[model samples]
Target: MESLLELKDVSIDFQSKRKSFNIIKNINLKIDRKMKYGIVGESGSGKSLTSLAVMNLLSDNLSIGQGEIILRTDEEKVLNHLSKKEMRNVRGEDIAMIFQEPMTALDPLYTIEYQIIEVLRYHRKMSKKEMREKAIAMLTSVGISRPEKIMNDYPHQLSGGMRQRVMIAMALVTEPKLLIADEPTTALDVTIQAQILDLMNDLTDEHGTSILMITHDLGVILETCDRVAVMYAGQVVEESTVKNVFDNPQHPYTQGLLKSIKTLGDRSEKLYSIPGNVPTPDEYQELGCRFATRCPFAFEKCFNEEPPAFQVGSDQTSKCWLHDEEANPNE
Candidate 1:
């Protein structure tokens, strides 16, 4: 499969007056054309930051220290090196992102129609009438009822679900090649969350757009993605197909995550939880496995040396000393 986007050794750092530290480290990801890829991890695990880095929407304090974010389509371009103006051209036309909170993402001052129309105006050379017509059509396509009326209202006027649908419309209006959804279903009720996920799946399928679904919800990943990347402490600890992730998670962090998910018909008084919190960027280990601090199976080697990517299967790789045959020769 041809890759639509590739992140090679991508690292993001936050620079402060006192010191600087890396938030995302040596991340390598490949999203093939129309491949539904999911990045799952706990909050502050660089899930949203990774997506922001891809979109070049990181804050001014944050910078890409080393790496190339390559976008391959008609021609290959390194997105990280592109100038602000060039990146703007690539943003909506080639890549669009639906942020977590639609209320905050959408401008409160602008009407829904104006927001959607703005996208078309920037990406497509269309007249006012054409932009308005297309905006209405886009809203309708996202299953928004009374599209015309909704368009006239501001972001605050619509329900949470409706605002999210409008966000989806704005994102897909340009028919981008890649859609980065950073927790698109966050803050919605479970029923609404499912609806939003279904709508995204359907729209992306219709448009043949690949999705980089960034969320903490394993259920969402299982339901929506073809492939999964499990991130821990700003690094990809495991990468595999969705089925493999659910059925045979390898890395300790991945296994912990799976175990933490509650199953129906279980009557345990307490829910399963992973021990300890994700280390802050500054607290990340400099010379050892990052998860060693929390991993129950950690050994002296795990605490002293960083593990390389160990091929667990033909399609899966895990970064753990347990998977390193040299370290565990008998196993």
Candidate 2:
């Protein structure tokens, strides 16, 4: 299938005094139309930054120093390497993003009706009456009860979950082909989180929209994503189908993540854990494999040079020298 979004040799950097600081490095990804893809990593692993890069929402100080992000539509293609003005038309119209915190994303002074209608008016040429009806329908679709009443209320009037629903409603109101949801359910209560996930899953399926789900929760990724990309220190260490990743993780870092998940059948006296910490981008400017510090199976070469993604299966790739023909002469 043709991809809805493709990132080729993507790299993001923050510029300082005569020096460039890298946040993400040589990242390549392809998100197919209507596919649910998850990007999982610890905090500050450039997961959010990557999503922002795709959306062209990076701040002025930071920029995509290298790489091309190609967004494909049946009619046209927009590249992230384009000017900011061109990106503005692509975001929300072709691609929409729902941030982690809806309260901050929504204007405090604006009513839900005002916000939703603004999106409808900006993106679609519709009568006022039609916009109102569409706004109400969107609210209802997200499981917001009494959409009529909620539409009249300001951001402070609704609970966190309701506000998030409103935000999702606003994003979907545009009927964007690609939805970038950054930890959409992280703040909600467990039950509310389930509802929000269900709503997103249902809505995406119904709209045939592709989703780039940015999350740290491995469980949530398994629950909502069709394919998974495990990132470590700003680079992808493993990429595979969700089942393949969970069942046969080739990278030790990927295995660490799975072993950490609580299971009833787990027999170990102590839970599995990936030791050490993720180095700050500045800390590893000269280092090779970023995860070598934490991986128990690391060797001398892992600390000396970076490993590129080596194909392990038809659709799986891992960035470890263990599988390299040069490193593993026996293979």
Best TM-score among the predictions, by candidate number: 1
Per-residue CA lDDT of model 2 for 1-331, tens digit only, reads 6788998899888887777688899999999999999999888888999999888888977888788888889654657657778777787788999999998999999899999999888778999999999999999999988999999999999999999999999999988999999999999999998888888999999999999999999988988999989998889999999999998999989988888888887777887778988888887646668888898877878888898899999989999988887775345
lDDT, model 2: 0.89
Q: What C-alpha lDDT do the candidate models reach, one value each?
A: 0.93, 0.89
- Candidate 2: residue 141 Cα off by (Å): 0.7
RMSD of each: 1.1, 1.6
Query: Residues 225-262, candidate 1, lDDT per residue (tens digit)?
Result: 99999999999999999998899999989999999888
Clashing pairs in 2: none
**Error in Å for residue 223 of model 2:** 1.0
Candidate 2 differs from the real structure by a C-alpha RMSD in angstroms, to one decimal, of 1.6
In candidate 1, stretches whose alpha carbon ends up further than 4 angstroms from where it belongs are none
| Best by the lDDT measure | 1
In model 1, the worst 10-residue window by lDDT is 322-331
Error of 2 at 322 (Å): 1.1
Q: In candidate 2, where is summed lDDT lowest over 10 consecutive residues?
A: 74-83
Off by over 4 Å in 2: 265-269, 328-331
